[model samples]
Target: MKFDFCTLLASSLQICYDACCTFRIWNLQVSILIFFSLFLFF
Candidate 1:
């Protein structure tokens, strides 16, 4: 039972970490797109 609980906790932590990484990448891509659009407009 303890082992299962540990595994569950580890998986949850991994998922949270992955989500944060994806969010950061998404934000970076959005910012880059906006910068390019502004540059083209001007």
Candidate 2:
């Protein structure tokens, strides 16, 4: 029972970590796009 709980916790943490990484990458892409658009406009 304890092992199962530990496994569940570990998996959940890993999922959260992956989501954070994906979000960071997406945010970076958006920032780069905006930067390039503004640079081009000027």
lDDT of 2 by residue, 1-42 (tens): 254645655765565566567786665555555556546644
Candidate 2, which ten residues in sequence have the lowest lDDT sum? 1-10
Candidate 2 lDDT (Cα, 0 to 1): 0.58
Q: For residue 22, give model 2's deviation from the true position in Å.
A: 0.3
- Number of backbone collisions per candidate, in order? 0, 0
Candidate 2 ranges with C-alpha deviation above 4 Å: 1-3, 24-42
Which 10 consecutive residues of model 1 have the lowest summed lDDT?
1-10
**For every candidate structure, what is the RMSD over all alpha carbons to the true structure, in angstroms?**
16.0, 15.8
Please give the TM-score that candidate 1 achieves against the real structure: 0.46
- Model 2 — TM-score against the truth? 0.47
Model 2: how far is 29 from its true place, Å? 20
Candidate 1 regions with alpha-carbon error over 4 angstroms: 1-3, 24-42
